[model samples]
Target: MADPFGMTELTEILRTSIGLDADVRFDGELAETEFAELGYDSLAMIELASQVQRRYGVRITDEAVLDQMRSPREAVDFVNSLLAGKVA
Candidate 1:
């Protein structure tokens, strides 16, 4: 399967989901910035995860996995891995 969400796309989703400033950088920040630093509470994460499932068709049903996704880059990587597994 093709990569449904590129880093840019994933970053955009995260930015929108977390209500970040449009000018905020994401490339390096995405990997380093924790979700809490971006003002994402547990409710926000649940919403984000739901949006991810809806938009990417990747089910993130595990709370542990969601807890592990501390940054946008991690979320993007996890989603890509799930997509790759489907293709394989």
Candidate 2:
């Protein structure tokens, strides 16, 4: 099945959640970019996760998985996997 959420939409969601400056042009393609590089700390990740849960109805309760999500692409892939029933 195709991803319910496209990468662009996910990127926008991530950008909104991260609250980047207007002038700060997020390339948004650096899928491997670490959250720390984007000035996101653990709290930010938690907030992002909460946002994802609220928006996608997918609860990501695993701390390890959360910790492993280093970029918006990773989060998006995880969410898509959940939506596809590829993850439990």
Candidate 3:
């Protein structure tokens, strides 16, 4: 199995996907911070999902991206769960 999907990796992908960078460090606050509040939109979230699928070979739907993976913490947990066979 691959390494666990984590916030640091998500942060990097998100930064590139949105074409901007912020000081959203990985912390309790950041974990719960919504992408919209970070100045990122659904399209950017879609791009992040695309990058994750390309790099990890795991596909998560845009609906899932919008509904479930609203924040970096949620994304990390969701991807790790999928990678762990916890979600089919």
What's the alpha carbon RMSD for model 1? 2.4
Q: Model 1 off-target regions past 4 Å?
A: 1-3, 15-18, 62-65
| Candidate 3 wrong stretches, greater than 4 Å | 1-3, 20-22, 86-88
**Local accuracy of candidate 1 as per-residue lDDT tens digits, 2-27:** 56776677667767775667776767
Extract clashing residue pairs from model 3: none
In order, what lDDT does every prediction score? 0.73, 0.68, 0.80
After superposition of all CA atoms, the RMSD between model 3 and the true structure is 2.7
Per-residue accuracy of model 2 over 1-88 as CA lDDT, tens digit each: 6677666665666568766546543355566677788777888788777777788787787594456567766766777877678345
| Best-matching candidate per TM-score | 3
Task: State the number of backbone clashes in model 1.
Answer: 0
**Ranking of all candidate structures by their TM-score, best first:** 3, 1, 2
Query: TM-scores, in order shown?
Result: 0.78, 0.72, 0.83
Model 2 residue 88 CA deviation in Å: 10
Measured on C-alpha atoms, candidate 2 has an lDDT of 0.68
Winning candidate number (lDDT): 3
Weakest 10 consecutive residues of candidate 2 by summed lDDT: 20-29
